[model samples]
Structures are given as C-alpha cells and as structure tokens.
Target: MPSPSRVLKLIALLLDYPSPDVRAESLALHALIRTAELPEARRDGLAALLDALCQGDLLDVQERYDSLFERGRALSLLLFEHVHGESRDRGQAMVDLLERYSAAGLAIDANELPDYLPLYLEFLALGDAEAARQGLVEVAHILALLAQRLAQRESLYAQAFEALLALAGVAPELAGQCYQAQQEAVDDSLEALDRAWEETPVSFTDPAAGCPSASPRRQPAGVEQPLQWVAQPVPQTHPRATR
Candidate 1:
C-alpha cells in the first residue's frame, strides 16, 4: 500500500486552484502519480484527471472550480460547510479544528479556513499514516457525496474524491448509502443551490462556546508576531546654559 502521506499529497495537489503555471504543475503531478504505488484503478483515475487538467484551458478550469466550489454550497470544499452550514455549530467546529491544527504545529493562513479540503489534506500529510487513514475514514461519507455530485456533472475532479474513498477503504455499499442520503437531502436545482449559499453569518461571542480557554494556545509555525514596544519619552538634559 502507498503511504498515506504520499496519497494525501496527490489529493492536495488536485484540490488546489489551477494556477497560471498549471501545465507545468500538471506535468509534475503526473510524475508523482506514476510512482505513487497506488492501486491500478485509483492511479488511472488520478492520471485521467491530470490529463484533463493539462489539456483544458486554464480559464475554463478556474471558472469550473469557482462554480463548483466557491459559488455553490452543495459542493463547497470546506468540510464543515457540508455538516453545519452557517449554524453556530459550524463556528464551534471550526474553532475546535483550528486548535487541533495548532496542536500539530500546522499553521493555516489567515485567509484559509482550517476546514478547507486542501488544508485538511496538508494536515493529514504531515501526520502518522495510520492516523491519517483513520481520519479520512471518519469523513468518508463527505468524500463519497462529493464524488457522486462531481461525477453527476461529469467533472474530472470527481476522480480525486474517488481516489480518497479508495484510500480510506470505504466499502461500496457504504459509499452508496452516503450518496443516496446526500441526494435525498439536496434539491440540486439552480434556485436551491443558490439558496444554499445564502446562509446567515455566524458569530462566536462566548469564549466557552468556541475554543475553550482551557486549551493551551501555541503560535502557528512560520508566523512571527512583532514585538510590542511601549513608547517612553527620552529625558532631555537641559544644555548646561551654554549661552
């Protein structure tokens, strides 16, 4: 079996936004996939996605990503979004997850939420392989739903989710149940999709509600806080009446 870290790295690469240098990135990604030592089916699925990404126009890829992930809540990349939406529960969940990342010395960028798929994958990539696999399995239902939705749209990105399911060792019957539950819950119409994104804002005011104060706070790695200096007036010695 391929190490969990290696599998996660490939998933993270796929989840990232296709930059202007995507062609070159795709080339490199393909090389990694070739030696990933994944099962034949999983490897081929990943390779197919790479081929599609490399062959497509960068603009189309960017637009598709935005439409699928950013504009629509049904396909949002943030894991908690699927579970909690704009509810207070989601805020609390985010705070708890942020603390977990902090404990692991994983520094998330200010603009990136800890629940984002790519960030989550990066965190997994840095952890114990067995633990990562267990974590992935815990979220297997989410992955399965994502795969089903993407496959419904005939998007190549569906392959990434499929690869994740394979890595997590999710049984086909379980995956089917997850997909069926998601489909039943989601309306999937254009209006319904739009409404899903129009969620009310969530605020975390109570310290007890979010990250508990009891949890120790550690500065994220690679971030430096500027030193605070208290302003003090310098004593001016009266020029000995040098008149």
Candidate 2:
C-alpha cells in the first residue's frame, strides 16, 4: 500500500480548478485512489469525486468548480481567509508561510500564493508523514469547515476535504461551522478503530506520481524546516462538550 501522501497530493488536484491536463489524468488518478491504503469509505468517496470530474462535460465541470469556490469568500481556497479574513495580520502570516515553504525547498510561482490549500497540501505531500499530519492539524478546523460547507452544498469536493480530515486524524463529523477539530473527543471506540486500521502517515513517493496542476512550482527538497510559525490564531473556536 502506498502512503496516504499520494492521496493528499491527489486531493490537492481535486480541489484545484480543473485543467485539460487534470482531465487527461483521470484514469491514472482513479487507479491511484483505488490502490491507496485507505478505508473503503474514504476510497469510495474519493472515487465518487473523480467520477464527478470525469463523467461530466468539461465546461460543466469547470463551471461547477467556479460556482463552488471562485464566487465567494465562504469557500475560498486560500487558507487565511477563514482565519484572518481581510485583516492586516494575514499579510504577515502569508510571508511567514512562504518562508517556511521556501525552507522546505518548494518555490512559490508568481501566480500562486503561499496559503492556497492545494499548494500547502503539495508541500505537506513532499515531506515526511508526521509533518504532513501536523500541517493538516494546524488547519484542521478550516478543513472541517470546508468539508461541512461543501457537503451542505452537496458538492463532491467535500470528499477531498473530508479525506484530509481523516488523514489529520481528527474526530469524525465535526465538519465546518468553525468547530475546533483538536478539541473534539476521540473515545475508546474511535481509538480502537484507529488502532485496527494502523495506517502510516503520507510521505514522499516516486516523482512520477506528481500532480501537474501545481508541480510546475516545486523545486528540489531544501533544508527541512519546522512550521512552528504556522500558528492557529485561536479564536472562540469550539464549545466544550460534557462527558
């Protein structure tokens, strides 16, 4: 079983605006998901997303992508929007994130910002497993929010976000609504279930598996850098639940 990092990489592509190149790789992407060491449900949901991408007219698919993500701040692909909104702090946060990615050996194309979720995921995909999970956990609440909003809109894109939450090892069903993901409880049953699966974190794989949408920006691995700076600007996030 390949590491789940490939799933992260693929999910990044799934989340991005569809391109002809992306459409062309549909078959390979499906094969990759089919063989990933994921739970049946995760694999199925991902496959359904791929199906949505593949089975529809190209124009229709592109329109749907624009409708869900491009039209509003609610589902912005940039991670900071949910956290910083239009604040000045978002500017500094962007600089900090770019430096961290630079330290990781990934370059920022003039066309892309450092905080875009797919680009961020690509950086996580290139590194070791623990780092990737930490990257996801750092933004776990945002992922949940995106998942919840997408699911509410009945968008297949929700599957990609939900799959990311699973990889982050966040508790189930806390989609969006500004829920604090780390605060969610993982009871005995959930822990045992996790143990039963015992999956490893996503790590770098063969270079051939790279997704084309964002790969043009990747350089070689640089000195590994810690993202300690990617702090969660903790807000009034989650309500405490009583046991």
lDDT (0 to 1) per candidate: 0.61, 0.63
Per-residue lDDT over 15-54 for candidate 2, one digit per residue giving the tens place of the 0 to 100 score? 8777676778988998898887677788899999988888
TM-score of 1: 0.73
* lDDT score for residue 191 of model 1: 81
Per model, how many backbone clashes are there? 0, 3
**TM-score of decoy 2:** 0.72
Q: Which stretches of candidate 1 lie over 4 Å from their true place?
A: 178-192, 198-243
Clashing pairs in 2: 5-202, 144-176, 145-176
Least well predicted 10-residue stretch by lDDT in candidate 2: 234-243
Off by over 4 Å in 2: 174-243
